[model samples]
Target: MGGVVERTDLGRGDDPLIGRVLDGRYEVGQKIARGGMATVYQARDLRLDRTVAVKVMHSGLADDPEFVSRFEREARSAARLSHHNVVSVFDQGDDRGTLFLVMEYVPGLTLRDLIRKDAPMDPGKALELIEPVLAALAAAHGAGMIHRDVKPENVLLADDGRIKVADFGLARAVNAETQHTATGGVLIGTVSYLSPELVVDGKADARSDVYAVGVLLYEMLTGVKPHQADSPIQVAYKHVHEDVPAPSLREPALPAYVDALVARATARDRDLRPSDARVLLHQVRRVRQALDHGVVEDPELYADLMPGVRPIAEDTGEVTGELEREDRISILGADDVYDQDREVTTAMPPSGVATAVPPRPPQNLAHNQPPRVVPPPVVADEPRRFQQPKRSRRGLFLLIGVLVTALLVGISAWQLGRYTTTPSVISLSQSAAKAKITKAGLTFKLGKAEYSEKYTKGSVMDTDPAPGDKVSKGGTVTVILSLGPERHAVPTVRGKTLEEVQQLIADADLSLGEVTQAYSDLVDEGMVVTTDPKAGTLLKRDTAIDVVVSKGPKPIDITDWTGKSAKQAQKSLEKQGFKVTVDEQFDDTITKGKVISQTPNTGQGVKGDEITLVVSKGPELFAIPHVRGLRTNDARQKLEDAGFKVKVHHSSLFVGANYVVTVSPGEGTMVPKGTTVTINVV
Candidate 1:
């Protein structure tokens, strides 16, 4: 959308119906162009909300019932065609005697405009423009609809560089009943581009369209029509009596093969031209490839493009015969004529030639004058000459007969040996392969089918004699088909043991690859956790499948702590993967900082095992306040008995006084039994 620009008009202001809307759906905006039978307008499809080109038939033609019926029929036929290079016909309707066709509106100049702007284009560019047009015509021809009119004006070159052919069946409708003018009568096709058959008899077919394209291509490459005249009748006469000259004559630098292409397509004898636009399309592609490869002369390709010798005077015409014979010499060498059945002929006379006429009136002077004397006929006598003996003549005839018979036999044998070969049907479906084989004069039989990695099921894989191998005409060829890829699905072996999984893999046409062990919560030990390329995975036959087995949950070891610090012991046990719990207890022998005992102190346990540790609280203590009033020795003995040490301090003035007058001011207190007690005496 960012790069696209919407076009609202076709830049024409002379049309009267520029702003008119028809059928209550199309909002006609501007006039694109006017043709012989219709005037195209840029219009919007209000119902579909899209831009389209509306081709409205001339009011006079629309008023005719026969023309309208044919128009509608041809419109439907064109609508049935679906191709990338064709302009799509969307809808057809009539509003108040105005017949119109809604078609895709391409936003670019027509090929006619391109030719006018860039005449004498290079051969490569000329082929590029014509290829898509041929493709469009090929689609129509394949669908049994002939594009009676194929010219540059009908070929649309879109802004995106896409070439599309427009007016698929319009030409047939316009030329259906052969409109005649008050002046000299002529056909509806463009004069300069009309085919010889069309101009002569007003009859057209796919080959006629091919002829038009050929003329168009010639004009593109030479900037002029192959035949030109002031009047349409005269131009039509040349088309019938003369052959289209090669493009190289006008553009002398053009390749000879290019000339051959033009000559083959525009041959005055329709039989000599491509049978249809599809065949012409193939020839065009081959010529384009040759040009791209810079091939200046390709006699082999030229012979193929224009097969067989040019038609003689008996086949086409003296004028055409002479030109074809000369063209073939330059196009394909004189010695390179490929022999083929000559089945086509141009027998019709030029149009407006007045084939039917009334008898002329008798002369009135013959009755008034006396009859003149008639002369008697006379005969001349001739002399006879003696001939050879009958026996000698018979002997000469017999020898000639034997020589002709031998020549026929030898030619037939060579043809059978050289032209017959097994056609390639590999990768084709069975029905398609059979059709090809039968068409090639060969019998086909279905042979054994085997699994293949490349071809689809039921498609031909190989042949008995192989494709391109020499075979006799009507020889039998056996075909082998594919059964599709050979693949096996991995079997489910989640709960199966290693040995059982291996056996299952083998049963599934697979090999046991790598076996790995891993701890799994769901699967038990020695059981498969899962198989690589898991269950139901399609793989090639005998593909290795990895397996993972389960090991039981891992075990952890507990550390002993009979004499280690309780806090340090709890940290050490937890680090070893055990849950630790501490309990306080009074122990007189064991140190207070040491762990007295532990639960599950030394054993193997899984992760998350609890280990309880009991720590020592030291000896019990009692109040020593009453010991301060007694002597130092007595207090010492009391404190020591209570698991405490006692000391006496003497004052300097009362050194001899060891009384308890001033004992180190002590009161009733509870402490660890190992605490020391001191007393003062004065």
Candidate 2:
């Protein structure tokens, strides 16, 4: 009500509705403005891709079905009057029992801001700004709708230089309900602009809006409110009994007719004022015309603006302000004015018409008498307010009244305020929910908390006896709070068996998913190596965790290299990541430098294992023994001893038995180790 989002305070995190998306369409953002009655929020219309302003009603009013019904009904009525000067109502909704209204977001400042900057402004300038406001009101009045709340805060000055009226029919929606006193004896609506009749009886029509505009005009001219008092109650008291002073008292340069315009509109009696905004707009144009003509002395226009029948204050025009709360009936603290049913100052009859004011209750009555509230003075033609009815008429009315009272009591016995219904508190904070329950005369019971993904931690998740359910007076209301989402840390399962790993996962509140086996030299066969998500990861309940298991050292088949080229074998084995070594030995039949045998040639080994190849180095060589000129028998014995086969031959020139000759094969020759030598005899 104070203004829109442009010049508002920065958003706060504690406001529950700050980040909420209503009806899955409007993303409610920051707090724009806070007033006595409602909160305004900057929001985005996700569907339309535009910004909007959302007005959220207080919990006390939103929870009231009767108030909600009136609000919705009046909202629909306001939406029908599509004036460029009026702020458009885009939609109205109840999101989880938090009632809100979406309206066009005008980016600029409020008239309140303008007033703060340029009060005591030129009359023509003031008229220029207010003329559009009156046109807006005139259109609504033409549509037979009354804007019960009209004030500077509800008027917007756009960045594009357009003036608009906002929150139409909102005050009427609040006032149309049975007049009820809110907590702390607080009043409703902006107090400075409240009409005398509205303060007196909580009733308003088009003329009431005219009165507020009159107040606006007066403040614009004088730069101050007409009434001043110690408290809001005192201000309301003055609206009822005092008259609004002329603006000329503050600024003497003004013509008297301007004074008359303010005086006539702010007249204590509604009958003396213009019937509606249209009538007032016509009068304003006449005054503007006179001002344009520079007609300083127009007693004719003055007389026309202020008839002789109406009374105008010629007081000092001193500004009246201390603490102005709600602009309604001032009967407060003391019993200045009151009646039964604290909800409303003036009680209504079945016909929906306000009854005549009851006589003020006697103060300091007999000790045995109960207390009574003094009622406001009634609007009546008769002067003798204390006059009693005739005895005969009184007797007949009393008998019927007694019977009606008895019947009403008998019918209302079941309820009769003996119980209260549970308020809608879903999604509210725990403290806030508890406050509502306790305020409704129900006990606050905290049930077990639960993990919830939808609700924030420490906020209410659910409730027993639910919203709108009737509960016995002082009955306990059980509420469940959110503990946030469920999560657990995955346990370490490496080096564990399959059964052990499954048990560990289950203990961690996780499910076992696919299990894979891999070769691990360190871990034993069929043992878990590690988990896929790894150990110590925080995961939601029942989330499947995959694991890797060890199948022990892998087996590698070695190729047999016996009787093969040793160089080729070494190359093949080394290329396959195996370390190779060689061994050589002389052989009689194998080729030189060929493989004789391989160690563990048929066994299996993993990669990086060692392989041994035995290669052939060819046959051994020896020198033949020298047996020339020796006895043949001796030579033969010596050849046999030298590991060779001996042969004896007697030549034709042989010496005789045991004679020696040159050996056939030359002695001292390189030959095979088993080569034979022969000696000749003559």
Candidate 3:
């Protein structure tokens, strides 16, 4: 109910539908069953003109990339299952955000329905119903698939009275990555039919399934389940502690053979039950055959069914009296040996014919009775009876002596046989005892551990023989398993410097081993860094682990050489591992010969890094030009155009005319871009 509850997207306009039609060929119908991860629907395949069952996953999970991937993988896995008892998976698809599977639609009532009717079914018929189920389980389990949930609801009884196991939805493939169900919780199966192992440890095996089937068989015969506690937990506890009662004890009319089979299947010890589904299947067939042919009575089966009731005695040649003879060869036919309520009697003449005999006359009896006809004198009754009673006492004593002697001889022989019983020596190493046990034709069972502080981890803790107790050949000796050593959580060593982490490890009684480094933008430079084993992981004492430390980024420095030759600058810095940049220029005061100002200014930190510089070459100069024309200032402007700044002057030599002549610093002289010149009129 907590999984996929609604079918809004899967439903039609008014009708509820969940899956899409495949190849434009099949139209999936409404949802028929819903599970924690997927929903099943009945569909019609148009191309084949047949009906099919479609299992559509919940929309929420269908959208999950991981779930869809696993769904497709499981579909393929289910397809590989070709057993007749297993339902066939025909197709699978991921359409848009929906995932679904097309399967065979089995039309029939589930085993749950038949069980709920609460009527006694023929024991033989019940066996017949379970036989094929066991067969299916055998094949499925043999192929490494475990039907985690084996319950009445999952077993379909077809109209033709054939059984087909359905819903491998919870089944898991062994030795595969899909062993765990999608939902990660304690993997206990359905409560009512859950095995004891499923209850206690949440681990299931073939024996666990055997236990569930046993419960089913019990229910079939008695019309009642074995343990009926208010809750599943309580019932599970009873299964662990209480030995299951035979079905015949609860319903006396049921055959004892059924009880024996159920008891074996439901044995609490996993090893005591059938090893796997195959063995269980064989047993089921055997028992089914016996039941079908009316060969169901078992000689040793009565112990559990009728514990205190003495079985009807078998005939022996020793019985001599008329009543003994009548019982030995029961007067009735063998068919009448057992009556529904009481033992029936039928007259059988000595000749084996059903004939009656007439009574004889007294006169005929007197004719040859005795040779003496004389009558003895009658004495008072007490005196004669007392003497006769003493004779009877003597005869009784003789019989008692004979019985005691026979019993003593029988007991002596039994004691001699018991002396040959081998002692059960356990808790010694497995190999040490294996030889001796095998020699004696005995087996051993291993038990859970009982911790010991004195003995070493795997040393002998205790034994069943207690050093000298005797046991018979083939007797089981259980050795206790070891729990190894105690340990504590390794302290958090992350974020600490390498020295500090090592010191912490030493303090915790552990040792530092290999050290590896990795880039971490978060951690600081040159600090003790994190460890690979992580911190706070519980490990055994003296365990060695690897640690990692950080190394800061490499450093680079800035350098300068201002007035040096560009070539000289390159040579000076190259020697110090620094790159240089240079540019030439003219200076007013500094000569073209030497270096001027240096950067990374003197006495500053010289990291021999990159350097940029400016150099001086020579002084600034200008050129002069000649111009003689009216308006002397205008004449100076024309002279300045020839490479010198304007220097205008008035001319006194000519009347009403002012002109300019040659100037000093002649024209065409190399000069600085901005220089001025003076011109005077003469």
Candidate 4:
């Protein structure tokens, strides 16, 4: 077969075993998901007796020396960092040649999956979803780590519904190192979430991460993307050319504040946008809080405009409905029955009286009776004449009081609207629940069913609001549904010890239904040879299973080795996989070349064991040289050079053995080389 490609499997399948020792220490379990670089598996750590996710590179990639080294190094770096939000890297090693990274296995769906099922969240809720992401990013940023990919796929939603960001530094490692082209081409990260700067320059900084997060926020607030295109490249172009549309445009009921937030986040000019995730997060949170209160945020500017700059034009007076009509009336000449009394005499009523009243005749109207007989000194009642007219005092006061009461009522109604409760739909089937909510004049959101042992499948477990609460129209309500009993993926129990294999099955929430033994040379005793259902196959709870174990390889007997030649002894020991060592010595009575003593006696040694031996050569033999009288020093030297020990019993006698007076082993005398020789004095 051709070389296999290395990658993480996002889909379900069997985890392919590579190298030797299928379950030397860890019991391989079910396949979780696959990524561009490695395939992650849910496995049991036999040593620690805990479950973990193992990410193993494909044999093809692991075989590549460069990729393996880089993978190991990157794993080490990621392992050093520990944060609540970051997925923890626990261990990395090469079992034989299959390189793998073991990390804390988180059991949860990804944000991408969450978004796929439900999206375009309510403004308040969307902000809640992303706030934790911002917090995680902040922690990573503080540590000088950038999460190059901040898309929903990289965000995991735990069972508690809290988001935990994953794959922070993994992308850098994958991209920095080239991959086999015909193999798993391109890295695993989703391309849609990439920032423009990352796409163009292949560089991602805190700002770039911030940009990606902004994109995610945009998608969450708006049901769709800021701009969606047929291809990734087209989407990228739109990101650059198109400004983020206000969410209110899609859902007009959305507050303007939310729309502005999306606009600022997806600003085409990176410089014009928030410089970092911290700033973006703060703004997003503020909008989220203010959304409920109807706060329309104002855009930030460099400076408050300097005031008091005199304007060229005067302020046009505010023209109310009444004022506007008055102006129109003046321009069109009042359609009244009479003009301003200037030509009143021309038009007379049936009573022969002009409709227009004549203006006062240039005289102060101080006199009570129009200056009664003006000649009779006009005594003026100036106070009453100059007093403001009170022709309709009662009617005006009643109108003013009614206007004030209406204003108060309108304000109270608005306050009541703000406090209305979110609606609820409980104990209904999925279709029924949706219908009821829609009929009640609210949007319906369907979430993935969480497996529950207590509730039956397709039944609603609970709703966001308790049943029978008063919620404002258009308010969102979340419902939890049941998927009956939880299903587990039966782990591949092949090549594992019986004890270890049982633990794996249990960790997967499966039962050790039965165990069966079998004889096999390839598998060790008590080790699982194979299992039914194989691995990576899903099974419902309480499913029965069978496991086969190895009895062990046949045993080998010891061989005897004595009185053998050195070469024969070495060869015979090696054939049985025993390490051999040799040492030679001289013997006085034994003939030449025979084994003397052997460790363990060689009769009881097992295969693959070690043995030591002491070998003996022929009897000792030597030649001696004799030296007569000479200089005392020279005589001693000659006697000693003849392979003999010179002794002086009584050196006081003129010249003792010190002058080599006589030699016991004389020159040319035949003697055993191993024999000791001595010379005597006087």
**What is the C-alpha local distance difference test score of each model?**
0.71, 0.73, 0.56, 0.57
Off by over 4 Å in 1: 1-16, 179-186, 307-682
Per-prediction TM-score: 0.46, 0.48, 0.40, 0.41
Q: Whose lDDT is higher: candidate 1's or candidate 3's?
A: 1
Q: Which 10-residue span in candidate 2 carries the lowest summed lDDT?
A: 339-348
What global local distance difference test value does model 3 have?
Answer: 0.56
Ranking by lDDT: 2, 1, 4, 3
For model 1, state the Cα shift of residue 175 in Å. 2.6
- Candidate 3's error at 403, in angstroms? 70
Best by lDDT: 2
Total clashing pairs for each candidate: 0, 11, 8, 17
User: Per-residue CA lDDT of candidate 2, range 1-682, in tens?
Assistant: 5212224666686887777899898898988776534688889977546698999887877897657755766776776677899998767778888888888888898887787788988898888888999999999999999887688878889999999999887766766553432221222455567787776656678998899899899888877777766544555556665668778878999998998888788887798899999999999999988888989989899889883453233333223332133332332122333311111122111111222222222322211123344456788686656778655687888999999999889878868577677787877998899998988888999998866544679997666665666678999899978887667788988788999988888788676777889998788889999986878988655556888899887877889988888889999888766788898888978898789888879878876788888889887666778887778778888877877787788888765667676776778776666776667766
Write candidate 1's Cα lDDT for 1-682 as tens digits.
Answer: 0001122344755766777778788898877765456677888867546688888877877896546655766776787687889998867777888888888889988776787789999999999889889998899999999877666767788999999988888777766533422233334555566787786667788999899899899989998777765334445566766667767777989887788888889887788789998899989999999999999899988777653453222221122212211211111111133211110111123244443111211212111122233456786886887977665588888999999999999998888776587888988999999999999999989998866554689998777665765677888999889888767899999988888998899898776777889876577788899987789999755556888999854566777888888888988778766788889888878888789998987768765778889998776666766764566677667767877677777766566656665544365777666777677765
Error of 1 at 533 (Å): 47
- The ten-residue window of minimal lDDT in model 3 covers 356-365
